[model samples]
Each structure stands twice: as structure tokens, then as C-alpha cells.
Target: MQKKLVCNTLKVQWRTAKLLIFAQNLTMGTIMAKESYSAVLITQGEHRFYQLAMPSDVLSSCTFVSTRDEDPDKGFQRLLDKKRAKEIATYIDSGHGTIPTSIILSAQEICGLEYDSRNKTISFEVLSGSFLILDGQHRVFGFKLAETKIRVPVIIYDGLSRRDESRLFIDINSKQRGVPSELLLDIKKQADYENSEEQLFREVFDKMNGDPNSPLFGRLSPSKRVKSKISRVTFNAALKSIYPALTSRTPGEIQEILSEYLASVRDQIIRNGGDENILLNSITFRAIVSFFIHAARRVKDRFGPEYTIDNFDVVLGPLFDNIQIAKLSGTSQSKILDYLEKHFKGEFQL
Candidate 1:
């Protein structure tokens, strides 16, 4: 079998050697032509590691060794999910796909890795079935199954004890917290605005939060949980429902309108001895933002398109006066929206 494999490899080398060289050069200096890979060495505390990009085919060809506590010969990784791998493969095949996260791996002693202190790069031979995967098995295999080849970020730890390997795997799987969805939205809103309505409202949302005089000043949590602030996710969901209304408005104008509307609501609730912090609650806030278009429409029909905070304030007068919205604070978002809709459309004088 070994002899047959060697003969086949020699036959394929004549055809593939030039393509392999092209691939090595294409990555600009990271991948070496002689089956060697190099990357900058990064040190954190007592541990040394290399952060590099590897072609998925090369990485997936490396071995996966699982650890078992009873038998040290086996390794620590979880069983691979072929379904998840296939999904990733599909995404990779898609035109706009990206896998930005680093795939963690550990190298054995036999791989002939060397660190150059002068250049601050670690170079290593691409030994078959040598590097043990620590995390991202699915991603690696996904690339293996994919027809499209791409460079994937990788972290290689050169020397780790078996015990340390198990610990590292456990730490990575159990200790890490993913970035919040809301935070991702906020980041996307800033990084790729392109005059999108979603991005516009996000800017308006930020303005409302940053302005000292706005009713929501310092009271909107874009990323993490704050004690008395509304979540960005909830705010985003509410804003998405009013996309048509937001299409024609600028960020500054939207900010002013929302700030005034919120101020009026705050004033009405507080003067009527309602909970002053009612708007801070997610359910109440969602309903208010959802109700924006309705209030705006009423104000526009009664008085022209030159809508102001007072217009929304007067239009929403029946809502606060007739309905005790402060008491509906602890309800579900859908329930709160429904409750307000009944009053706003039917019983209220709007």
C-alpha cells in the first residue's frame, strides 16, 4: 500500500507541482514552496503561538487526534458533525462567504517547526497527520469538502502537554462567550453603512443615546446589558418595522423626531404619576417605536408633513391619557403592541 501510494504521489506531482508553487506564491509570503509554512510568532504570558493563514486543503489534510481521559493515546476534541461541515462547505462555495475566526491547532515534535527570533516568524514542514486540531474541526473539514479554496486564519501552539491540550480545548469550548448579536448589528451599521436605512436608524439611535437632553440619554444599551437601559436588539427590531417611514428621513431629523416623541411620552407618563422609567422597559419602548409611524401618519393627516415633537405629542395624547401604559411594562412585546393597537385604532381619539 505504501509503495503504491508513493508511485501515485510521484505521478500526480508532475501535474500538480506547478499549481502548488503558484498557490504558495499567491498567498504573498506566508506559504512556502517546499511544503513549509511560516507565520509571525505571538507570545502571551508564558505560552508561545503562531498566528497564520493556511489553505483549507492543507489544514484539513492534517490529522485529528481525540483525547480520552482513560486512554492518553486518544485526544480531547468532540466528534465531528458532518452535517455542520457540509453547511460550512455550502457557505464557502457561496460567492460572498468568509470565515474570519482562527482555527486552533497544536503541533507535535516531529513536524520540524522552528522560530526565527530575528524575523519573528515560525516556519514548519507540512507533515501529513501531524497537527492536532484543538477547535474548528467542522470548519477545517468544511473546507476539505468545499471545491472553492480559501485561506483560513489559524493559531498553532508548538509545544503543549497532553494535559494542557485537554485543558486548552475545555477552556476554549467552555470559557469563551460569543459577541452579542446586537453588537454585531451595531458594528455592521458603522462599518458598512452605504446609506442603508438600518444604518441610518442605528445612527439616529446612537444620537438619541449620546445626547444629554434626549429622553434616552445614556439609557440605550447597544452591546451589553445595562441596569436601566433598553437593549439595541429590541430597538433594532422596532426600527425594522418602520422601514418605509425611515426611507425619507435623515439621521439628524429622525433623531430629533424620536427624541421629542420620547420626551413627550416621558412627560405625559410622569405628570400623570405613571412610572417615569416605563420607557426604559424593553416592551414599552418597542411598542412606542412601533407606534411611531401611526402617530406620524395621524399628525401628517391632521397637519401637513412638517411634523414636530408636539405633533406626535398631541396625536399620542389619547394613548397615554386613556391607557395606563406604565402598568403594561412587564408584558410581552407582542402583547404590549397588541394592547396599544386596540386602543390606538379603536377606542382612542387619535
Candidate 2:
């Protein structure tokens, strides 16, 4: 019994020494440093996956597989977008940026992922080319290029067939509808997310849309399907075209000038027995704003510094008599603006 105990003790000592050597190999990066990650296991219909956060540098070490048209046998994933990756890197370095959406990945069976279901964790040894990038190829590369360290949200799937992976890539790219521009504009306002000029123009648009006395009141469409002549995009574009000229002025000053100018145009259209909405049409509005850049200066010079609707009305008197607002339909915005610039130059002899 004493001899048996001695043999058992030696066996235990050998096992402890082997474990110590294995741990030393891990510390030396020979076993590639076994890593454990906490994740939330999500199971849906025959699909199971893990949602977790991983360091960008850790993800950057994984290999990417792209299927090429010229070489059909090459793996699955689209080509890495180097330019987009660089742009994302720049954004990450900008100090107030993050990619909130999870990038999808697939772990090859060779990754030898060991999951502890009871603790909701996964542990794996880092192997060369272990994780296959199924989607967000650029994002992974972007993180690699970024100088900052970030914890990127990751969604990883294991045991998926190559066919299913390709199908998933196709589904994600083709099926998702992007956020509408109008909604984005609205969100930007609530978030106060843009530069001062952008905020200025959007504020001007809001004022014009809401004020009953303004010509644009109730004329701006809030949604993609425009019920009115001026969609938020078109109105913003019109204001943007003239932003440089208005940079010297405040939002209130700019608003007053636009309100007076548009009101004058509306009054002229009404006096000519033409539809006021004709002048309010997006194409016509842009042309008129472009013309205002030149006309405002002439009016301000003649009327001396503080110009009113009557001063603008005098300068625009020849517009209705010579030009037909309805006839401008189907003409491109650039063409209309160019024509009006030339027409006004000759009419006013300026």
C-alpha cells in the first residue's frame, strides 16, 4: 500500500509539471495565447450564434477569404475595400466615433472553439487563419488601420456551411433598406450633430415650413414621397447654393431676406394670374435663389443697405413679363438657373 501511494504521488507530480509547461508555452505565445471571451448565446430556429465585443486588433489578426469572379474556387467574401477601410480609420481617429453595428464573422471548425454553456463563455487558442470574415470585410481592416484601440461589436457563427455563408452575405447586402434622407435630417436636428452652417440652413427651413406668413409655409414635404413642391432635400440644396453669399449675415437676417424675396416672387406670380406654386417648384426656386445672389446686391446698392420686398419687387418686375414660369418644366435645374442669370442681366442691363 505504501508503494502504490508513492506511484500515485509521482503521477500527480508529472501531471502538474505538464500543466505548468503548457501554461508557459501559452505565455510565450507558442500556443498563441489561449483567449476566453464572454458572449450572449442567441438561438433562433436552427441557427445559433454568439454576440460579443472583441478588441479590433484581435480581429485584425484573422484571415480574410474573398471569392473572385476570375477564380471561382477562391473562398467566399467580397474583396476588401481599401479606400473605405482608410476612411473608417480616419473616422475612428477623429475621437468621437464608433461602429455600433456588429460585424459578422464565421469561425472555421479548425478554430477549436470550446464553449462553457453554464458560464456563457468561449475559449479558443489563436490559430493562423482561424476566423473567416463573412461580412464587414472593410470594417475589420479599418480597425486594423486605425491608431486607436476599440472594442468592436462582433457576431460570430460556427459550423455554417460555405453555401449558407455566401447566402447570408447576399441576403445582408440585398435585403436591408438604408435609412431615408428625410429621417436622417430630422434625426440630425434632434441630435444637434452637424456643423454651424448645416444647422443654420436647417433652422431656416424649419422656420419657413412652420410660419404661416412665409411663402414656404406647409410647402416642405417631411417624407420621401413629396406631396408639396419643396422636399427637405431640395430646400436644403437651394439654401446650400447660396450659403457662401449669406455667410456674412446671421440666420435671422438670412431668413428675413429669403422670406421677402420669395414673397415678392409669389406676389408677382399672383398678379400675373399665374399659379404661385409654379414659382415655388423646386427647379424654379433654385434658379430664383441663384439669381438673388446678383439681384440682392443691385437692390441693396440702389435702396442703400436695408432692402425690402418692394425693392426686390422693382428689380424682379421684368421677370414675370418676359419669362413664363410654366414653360420652365422639364428643363434641368442648371439650365434654368443659367438661362435666368443671362435673361436678368439683359432685362435689368446689369
Candidate 3:
């Protein structure tokens, strides 16, 4: 009697779960529950196999699988505003059932998605009986904003395991080709939702290129796909290495000084009939800045702490006296900055 009761309970649960999946299909106007069924067994001769009959709309339900860590409906609401939701609605309405697989799968595969005007909708299938969002919470929110109805694709699996789902989610995200550092930073920021600083560094390091030996290992590189660790350590180290002469000043003060100096250099470059864009693009500006900081320090150590940028014209010459500044090509920016700072004996003028 107890076994029969337990079997009945299982049956009720299965039915309820099926009803929910079917209801989603009906809401999208793709198929009616009667037309679609799950766990139906087909017998061909002596062979018997269970089959899940999904409609065209079922396949089209491209909405991402919710990660289960958050409530999809509520999470969507939080990530998207009303205005963007309307836009997504319009995109869905125009598509007449055809949606970009890339928009849907890319996010699923890449762990994130960007809003593209060209692509109106992104959809994915449910995993582990739930919809997990690999990416584009904002786009989903935007679609909701537009008040457009979206039918997302989903792959339904029975008895889906959490570990399996997470693995799939991570695998899809990590394999995205040609991801940018900025994008990785954004992902890291999202993954570490609590905004812990250490997690930020780890994610940044994971996304960067080149071996551990690369000077840019913990620093932002010129590559589009790489980023610096940007921890307090790197941040302070960068400032100290660049302007050792300014050691007396606090980190905050050093940042202010560097910001002002860079701004001045930018202005000067523009005024001198130099192509501001080209100057910024070349290593010359960085090299010159390094030279200036180091040279200023050398002057101060030899003379006194009274040295200033005005006196830089005279002091900078000896700092570059033995080294060929012109030949200092292809050197790492950080190295050049460090060498200059050390050589100058911590003497520099803003």
C-alpha cells in the first residue's frame, strides 16, 4: 500500500513538471499541450524507446537556462529596465519565429552577451529543468522593456544534475573565442557579485595572455584580450616604479600628480602640431615620460629637493646621457618606467 502511494506521488510530481514545460510552450503560441507530450514510448517491432515530442516552438524557446542561483523572473526584472524590455519585445515580434542562434548560443557559449542592434533576439534552452542565463541579462531586460514576447530555445533534460549544469555553463563561457579583457573584467565583476577585490584579480589574470614571465603578467597589455591585475599592489607598484622621486607623497597624491602630468603632456602634444592620436599610439610618449621622471630625480639628488618641471629642461639631458633613448624601442612600458625611476634616485618635479 505504501509503495503504491509513493508511486502515485511520483506520478503527480512528474505530471506537474510536464505541465509547467507545456505551459511555457503554450504561452509562446508554438504548440498546445495535447499536441506535445513527454516520456511517450515508441515501439518499433520489438524495440521500445522513450521519446519527447517537442514542437517547432519548443525548439525555438531560446531563452537561456536560469543559473538557479537566482530567480529568473525576479533576476530579469533586476537586470533590465522597462525601456529596454520594450525594445526586446519588438525584436521578437518582427522575427516571426526565426531568431539568431548566435545571439542565443553565443551567450550560452561565451558566458555573456552584448546588445546588438542588428540581432533582435537571443534564446537558449532550459537545462536541468531550469533556464540558466549564460549571458545577456540586460538584453533580456531590454526585451521585457519593449513588451515583446520572446520564445527562447531550450534543451530539456531529465534528472539534470547541478554539477553537470555548472560545468556546461563554465565550459560554454570559457571557450568563447577572441574575448576582450574589458569583457572578461565585466564577467569577473559579475561572477564575483559581492565585488571582492581579490576575485577581480584572479579573473583578470585568468583572461590575460602570454606566459607568467611576460612583464605584462600582472599589468594591462596592449592586446585587446588582456588586462592587468589592477590590485592595490600593482596599482601602488606602478606609481612607485614610475615616479620613485615622488616617494614622499602618498599613493593618492602620486596618482593626482601623474594624472596632472599626463594631462599636460597630452595638451603639449596637441599644441606642438603632433598627431595626438599617433603620439598616444606610439611608445615615444611613454618613453619620454619615463625619461622625464627619472631625469628629474637625478637632478634633485645632485642638486636639491628644490628641482621642478621648469628646471627639467636642464636636468633631463644627463639622465639619458649614456643610454640611447632613441634605441629604447620595444622595451616594456613598465620596465622603462622602472629603470627611469631607479636611475633618478627618487628626484622628480611634476
TM-score of each: 0.59, 0.72, 0.29
Index of the highest-TM-score prediction: 2
Q: Could you tell me the TM-score of candidate 1?
A: 0.59
Could you give candidate 2's per-residue lDDT for residues 20-135 as a string of tens digits? 99899877756775678999999877778899988888888764656665347746556677999999999999998878988888888767777889999987766656777777
C-alpha lDDT of all candidate models, in order: 0.78, 0.78, 0.43
Which ten residues in a row are the worst by lDDT in model 1? 28-37
- What lDDT tens digits, residue by residue, belong to model 1 across residues 1-350? 99999999998997699778878775654444334456878888778889888888888776465735534575566667799999999999996789899999988876667777776666665655468888888898899999999998999998898878887889899999888877777788457733575677678888888899888887888887676888777787778887778768788888887787778878878767888787877777887788777778888899888667777778778777888755568578777777777787875454
Once fitted onto the true fold, the runs of candidate 3 whose alpha carbons sit more than 4 angstroms away are: 1-130, 134-138, 146-159, 179-316, 321-350
TM-score comparison, 1 vs 2, better candidate: 2
Ranked by lDDT, top first:
2, 1, 3
Instruction: Return the number of clashes found in candidate 2.
Output: 0
Error of 1 at 285 (Å): 1.5
What is the model-wide C-alpha lDDT for candidate 3?
0.43
Residue 330 error for model 1, in Å?
Answer: 2.6
Q: What ranges in model 1 sit over 4 Å off?
A: 1-54, 61-101, 105-134, 145-170, 180-195, 210-213, 221-224, 231-233, 347-350
Better of 1 and 3 by lDDT: 1
Model 2 segments beyond 4 Å from truth? 1-35, 63-98, 108-119, 123-135, 161-163, 174-179, 187-192, 221-226, 229-232, 268-274, 278-284, 301-306, 347-350
